[model samples]
Target: MVNLINQLSMPLVEVALVLQKHITALMTTLQEHLDAAQQSANANVVKPWPLDVEAAESSTNFPVEKVMKVVDSQRMDILETLIRVTLIEIDASIIEGLLALRSWEHLVRTQLALAKGPGQLFSPLDIPEDW
Candidate 1:
């Protein structure tokens, strides 16, 4: 029984370990992208205009549209990363739930077997036919 439990649990542990590694990789990638985007934006800052009347006015005026566009684009990228991470987390939860269910099923079956004594046996057919 212990061996059976161990065998069933080993795969679940492996899957969790793999998922952790994947999440770590994704977080690292997200950080790198964010850093690169920030550096790119900073490096691409518009230069000040010449001292002519129109140029001076334009330089002094706030570029609301350009700033908004940069903000929106960066927000979208961050949202995308968040959505991906959320999906990974949901998948991990599902896998963990399945493992828990399997463990519970094994425990119930073991209890039944012990209660029914050594020579006696239990089978799936013992369950209700409708089930």
Candidate 2:
């Protein structure tokens, strides 16, 4: 959004920071527009609004389906944009995302265990009827 991409200089760190800023802004915009889907994702990415939260999941509101539609529409644009970038930059971003996901998984597990007690602890992978 800031147009900080100095192509002449080609500073990887500066470019990456610009990209990260844009991504964060985009995510913030999406979350504002698709709050229900965002909330469901934050609660459980795998099962997504699998709990009693389905009461609000209607066609009128932001559904995961709608989110997918929005994303799918831009899929090609995303690919096209990424295609211009160096492979190392894309790989670095992806690896960073994966690392963040791993850390998030651990944090979620720890939070769940603390909330439910040791005996009631369950892995997020386990598809239990109740969370």
Candidate 3:
């Protein structure tokens, strides 16, 4: 029986390995970006029900009331921005995962082609010969 590794095409295997490495690197970068964004969001997130709404409503001084409203509005804006950025980072990570999966599938196909033959690799409409 032939050694399986010997039957593998070296150049094709090397290319697949390079593609896997690049996909891994991309996934790492995406995860790092997501982690950083999540950390920022956690740091800035404020739990509801702590604001002094009753005090602000009952306050007679115009200046104090206006400052409180402005501060609250600004905080809301910052939270919204954080949420949007975090979501974008998460989406990027998902895309990276998909890319890695596709690369892995390609590697499987190539390996199968090397072990068997090109005709046995993939067919969308027909089942593989091994099955």
Point to the candidate with the largest TM-score.
3
Distance (Å) between predicted and true CA of 87, model 1? 12
Clashes of 3: 0
lDDT of 2 at 114: 40
TM-score of each: 0.23, 0.25, 0.29
lDDT of each: 0.35, 0.34, 0.37
Tens-digit lDDT track of model 1 for 22-59: 44554455447667887422211111112222211122
User: Over the full model, what C-alpha lDDT does candidate 1 score relative to the true structure?
Assistant: 0.35
Clashing pairs in 1: none
Q: List the residue pairs that clash in candidate 3.
A: none
Give, for candidate 1, the lowest lDDT window spanning 10 residues: 43-52
Candidate 3 segments exceeding 4 Å error? 1-10, 39-131
- What lDDT does model 2 reach? 0.34
lDDT of 2 by residue, 1-131 (tens): 11212213222222332344444544454456567565522433222122222222223333445433433324334433543354336564433433333333343343333433322222222222332
lDDT tens digits, residues 52-129, model 3?
A: 222212323235444334333343344334433554667754454444345343544444344332222222212134
- The Cα RMSD of model 3 versus the native structure comes to 27.7
